[model samples]
Target chain A: MLNIENIDVNYGAIRALVQVSLEVNEGEIVALIGANGAGKSTTLRSISGLVKPQSGKIIFEGKEIHNFPPHKVVEIGISQVPEGRRVFPLMTVLENLELGAFSRKDRAGIKEDINNIFLRFPRLEERKQQPAGTLSGGEQQMLAIGRALMSRPKLLLMDEPSMGLAPMLVQEIFNIVKEINQTGTTILLVEQNARMALSIANRAYVLETGSLAMSGSAKELAENEEVQKAYLGH
Target chain B: MLSNFFVQLMNGIALGSTYALIALGYTMVYGIILLINFAHGEIFMSGAFVGLILVTVFHVHIIIAFLGAMLFCMIMGVIIEKIAYKPLRRSTRLAALISAIGVSIFLSNLANLIFGANPTSYPPTKEILFPVKSFELFAGAQVTNLQILIIATSAILMIILQYFIKNTRIGKAMRATSQDYDTAALMGINVNKIISYTFAIGSSLAAAGGVLVGIYFGVVKYNMGTLVGLKAFTAAVLGGIGSIPGAMFGGIALGIGEMFAVAIGLSSYRDAIAFGILIIVLLVKPTGLFGTEIQKKV
Candidate 1:
């Protein structure tokens, strides 16, 4: 489980996140939905230690990890599938996956996990020797997710997994996310696609500008009138 | 005339091998951090001096001296990165570049203070290693044992380097870091360590080059790095700044070109010819021969 308490993030003169707080319980998919510049990504970035919060603390399983560097954060079992699917363009698919487990030392375990990932995403196996950048957008997104899973993180933070995908591909990616959570890994997903996100999430938080606007069960948030109008495009 | 050409070709290769060695340092560092590392030439100079001391003062074996110089420069390179470039990682590219030049100036001047302005020559190869004998290739195209040694040493180092980058885990991590620094961290790679590793590898190669040059040319001067460093920089740019194979090819090509300039009775314009080729390459193909189109993030 993870707890973020009153975290504030700023980009020089601009306040990106102000007194924002959220929580994710074990074995659940938590969705944080917002429009552009709504601080959803900033929230995920803060938790991942890519950006530091000026105030408050982030506790991961009872340890304060607010000041940890990004690599240290990953070492403590938190992995991020960053936005834009920043896979290493020149590296082969297998190499990218190998680097994902950079902090791990179990050779046998790594080999087995890589095989399991290949089984889950057969397209990746077919292109294991090909450079990652040559993959299609949907394939690259799958590779990104696969790369993150390589780290074997207990807490996976996904930022816009469905951005820039075809609608059908988006559905496939969401299905994969649901399948991943069903296997018992806690997921904190940030999305612009609120309808799809809420459909899969057990609990949801709505972000407006740089503050948390609302929080409730996924069903309640989806059916709420103002939430439907602002986020769901109803 | 044909035999004369062949002899010049061999000489060019021996010289180009050194350039190629130094150029690898430039290309690798630039690939990872996007810094030109102007102090690299000074690192080469330091390597030559270190090798000189080991051979003359400490009385070490030639092979031991070569390896020692590399080890010394590897540590030196990492320290330079920590002191000169690491703190400027978040600053502008210009700031890092200026810091590099500052490091370069500091290093060269330090060498000048220590070694003085006079050029020092290596002991005769016959006394230290082996007799310098010219072996005939054909009619009159001859190659010295020293030329063969230099070229073979450079080739072996390059082969080992290529294998290291291609097959090793740390090497793969290095490639990943070069491609995406932050994303690499997200995968649990300590990028700072990777950068240090890069500096270490690059500086070692430059050191190897320095020792080989000191042995081949029989002279090591305090300020030798200035012009040679600039020439190696030219080679890196000519071969495509960030491409590994490109640096090798560019260095050799520049070396041959310089020799050919001398062969064609334009000896005085040799340096001019090197820079002229760089300008032409930039105008014709700014990315150099093997460079991919650099993506600019918005």
Candidate 2:
């Protein structure tokens, strides 16, 4: 549902993304894998409109969305769970979720969805009244996903959701990602954890220093010897 | 002797109330926009002069005129934010600070042209709405009609303000916006609208304080804002610059401290004490009593 074509992003003198292109179709989890500073995050950021590209276009569904601001991007049914799980530390867990649905007017449905999120992640429900900042790293990651899900986005762009979690929590998150895909919500995920990401993704792109270096089915990429040696630590 | 202390206490409350009112504006504006509106004092002064003209020359009802002055000041505040602030929202806070000072100078000098330098006495008044019914809250205190009015009006205003901030949907948006601008925007909250709302609320409070001062002291001047605004700023800082309730505590504390300092035969040190208390508060409780300690990373 999201198409990006030859996007270029810069931070003043530094070129972050150079002529990069990617796409995530409906009901698919597309993974962008790269090392630190490989432009994976920048690509997602450009798509979300947090970082406007100097060149090229972003099409959500069928409309060009390169000009929209980050908030307006959310309104257009693309929600981003920013890197670092930037949940409002002072707000209650519930408040963070309420903020997730900020662009929607569907009050009762939003409320029901929130309840389902709590049910889906029982730990969050137990600490619902607590400030989000106080949650454990795993719980905070769950909170971040829950918050993103609040918007009921057509496409959820997750940036490194598995960055700092334990192995079991990482698996749990990937399981939830699959469950989310089963519910028909498309996701564009950027990750440094290529092994886990490829395991769950149907299709994947290897982003190397701001440009797409490789693209194939997740199984083929995982089986590729060079990919196995470099990304999978085999 | 006890009556003298009572008199001092009454003066403290009156002075404190004014400080509280202005400080509320400071806190509110600062909280939402993360701005230090140096022009706020001038806004208060401008409101006073506006009220003065309405009452003396325009012959408007004291009540409706009060509303009119506040509304006028509120609009001015919004306009100032639109002109001086909205454009500079993404710029550094220092730039916003300088722009605020520029607006302050503009408003004050404009008032100087309109009202002139001489102090204008609020046309002699027989009390229509006394701020409070004069009574002995305690046996030894002597509360005048004016002091009572100042205390009552301030208390009522504060209560109304508290209710607005705590229970309203707009208030929730304000708190959310104050916490995080980008995040608040992502949540479909219009950040600019909320910032303008903050300016409106703050300016109205200053207008109310200006009118109350006129009714209490029986004189309003173009320069009255300098002293009151500075004290209110001091209170805002003392309480915790971006904290809502901290401003109240700081304002009242500054007021009582100022009055007590003068009462103790240290009238020469009035300004000194206000500034000193502020310095001490900053050095000690930088967050102010009610301010959040979390340093919000923008």
Candidate 3:
């Protein structure tokens, strides 16, 4: 459904990604796993148009989007839940979700989607009037996902959704990710939590430094000795 | 003496309403894009002259002139944002600020060339609207029709603005944009469009204030915005740089404070007092009363 080919990205003097290529087919949850500064977040950022690639192409369902601005990228049905759950700190939860659908004009459908989000995350329904900044880390993560889902995206890019949650909350979040995938939204997930990511992801790629080091079926990569030693800490 | 005090207090309210109106333009633009928009004061000055032109040359009613000035400045604000602020969005904050100051100087000079640097009085209010009259609120406490008109119109405009920001979808997008620019774009909001809209709304309010100032003070000048603009900006900072309510409160407080100073025969130091309040506010609460502290994400 999405293809990134030989993309290079830089931040001034620092090369953030070098020759990074990856793909996600329809109805798949693809995980990009790596350590800090391993180009995982940069790859997702490049696809979402937050960071433009110096070279290579990003084709989403066939059309190139590497050069599109971030707002236009979302208009083409791509939504990103950025790292650290950057929800609008001063906006109420409902306002945050309403902004999620800023590019869309279907008021009734937008309202319906918001209700569905509330149903999925009942705590959000209870705290709809509260400022998002007041939410706990776990709840803020939920709000971030729920906000992205408000756009009715064809492809969702989730960056480190499990970064700072309790173990049980992390499990709950992974379960929710699987549930979202089952509902027909293709996902490109970047994570440092390899075990939980591999458990849910259909396929996985391991990135080292600024380059892709390995790719395979999720099970095989999980069982691979090198991935196990380096990522899984076994 | 006490009646004189009451009359002066009423005058302060009318004057402060104008300050609050202009201060909102500063605060809103600052909240969204973090630009001080030094040119904003020029926008106010331009509004007064535009109203004057419409009233004198076109022979329009005072109300029509007021609305015309607002519409003119609304477009002016958008044009200014696109030309001056948009190109510098990705550049350093200082670059945009310098560009803003440049625009301010250019606008004021342009106005001077057109209006000839002379202070022009508005048409007599009794001739245009109603008889120049005053209501006796109490012993020596009187409010003129003009003062009442200015205060009421400003209050109505402010309420409408408040409603628009609180209840509308675009308003929600605005708040989101102000909170986090990147995250707002990620939600598919055209951040540029929101910025332009913000400029339009704020400029309209400032223009309205400009017209009211002309009516209340009976005089308008090319460089009028220089001092009023600074006062409005001070009001914004005093209230908390980005807080809407803070701007409102700060303007009134400053207005009343200035009136009290004048009452105590310290009128010459009124400007100094305003800046003194700003310094003290910054020293005590640098964020302004309502300014939110930006959180650094890990």
Candidate 4:
């Protein structure tokens, strides 16, 4: 489980996130939905240690990790599939995946996990030697997810896993996210696609501007009049 | 005339190998951090001085001195980076560049203070190391043992460097970091450490080039890095600033071009010819020969 308490993040003169808080229970998919500049990605980045919170604390399984650097955050079992699927363009898919487990030392375990990832995504195996940049948008998204999974993370933070994908591919990526959560890893997903995100999430939080606007069970949030009109395009 | 041309070609290669070595440092550091590291030349100068001291004062073996110079410069490069460039990481590129120039001036002046303005010559190769002997290559063309040694050693070092970059885990991490620094950190790569390793490797290569240059030319001076550093920087840019293979090709090509300039009775314009090529490359193909086209992230 993870807990974020009243975290504030700013980018110079702009307050990207203000007093925002969220949590993810073990073995659950938690969705944070917001529009552009709604601080969703900022929230994920703060938790991943890419950006520092000006105030408050982030407790992952009871330890405050707000000040840890990005690499240290990954070392502590939190891996992020960054926004826009920033895979290394020049590196082969296999190399990208290998670097995902950069902090791990278990050679045998790493190898086995890579094989397992290949099994789960056969397209990846077929193009393992190809550079990740050359992959299709959908495939790059898959590679990004696969790369994050390589860290063997306890908490996987995904930022816009479905951005810029075909509708069908978006469905496939969300299905993969659901499948991944079913296998025991906790996921904190940030998405502008509220409908799809709410469909798969166990709990959901809606962010407006830089603060939490609403929070409830995924079903309640999906069916709520305000949530539907504002986020679900109902 | 043909034999003379062949001999010049060999000499050019020996000279170019040193340029390639130094150019690698420029290209690698720029690839990772996008900093030109103007102080890189000073690092080369320091490496030559270190090698000179090891050989003369400490009386170490030539091989040991070579390795020691590399080690010393490796540390020196990292230190310079930490002191001069690292603090300016978040600042403008101009800031870091200015910092680099400052380090360069400080280093060259420090060397001037210690070694004085006089150019120090290495002991005669016959007395301290091995006898210089010329061996015929083919068709009346002759190559010296020193030339062969320089070419062989540079080739070996380059091969090892290529292998290290292409095959090793740290090397892969380095490539990834160069491609995407923040994303690399998301994968748990300590990018700071990677940058340090880059500085170390690049500095070592520059050191090797420095020592080889000193041995070949038999003289090391405080300001030797100025013109040579600019030339190596030219080589890096000419080869494509961030491209590894391009740096090698550019260095050798520039070297041969200079030798040819000399061969054609334009020795005074040799430096001019090198810079002219750089300007032409910049105007014609700014990315250099092997540079990747910049992509807009969607």
Residue B105 local lDDT, model 3: 94
DockQ list for all candidates: 0.89, 0.50, 0.88, 0.92
lDDT winner between candidates 3 and 4: 4
Q: For residues B128-176, could you state the per-residue lDDT of candidate 4 as single tens digits?
A: 6699999987888999999899889888999998999999988998898
Q: What is the C-alpha RMSD of each candidate to the true structure, in Å?
A: 1.2, 2.6, 1.4, 1.3
| C-alpha lDDT of all candidate models, in order | 0.94, 0.84, 0.91, 0.92
What residue runs in model 3 are displaced by over 4 Å at the alpha carbon?
B296-298
Compute the DockQ of candidate 2. 0.50
| CA displacement after TM-score superposition, residue B188 of candidate 1 (Å) | 0.5
Interface DockQ of candidate 3: 0.88
lDDT of 4: 0.92
Report the number of the highest-lDDT candidate. 1
TM-score of each: 0.98, 0.91, 0.97, 0.98
- Which regions in candidate 4 have their CA more than 4 angstroms from the true location? B296-298
TM-score for chain A, prediction 2: 0.98
Show model 1 residue runs off by greater than 4 Å. B296-298
- Interface RMSD measured for model 1: 0.7
lDDT of 3 by residue, B69-185 (tens): 999999999999999989998899999999999999999999999989789989988877888788887776788988888889988998998899999988888888888888888
Who is ahead in DockQ, 3 or 4? 4
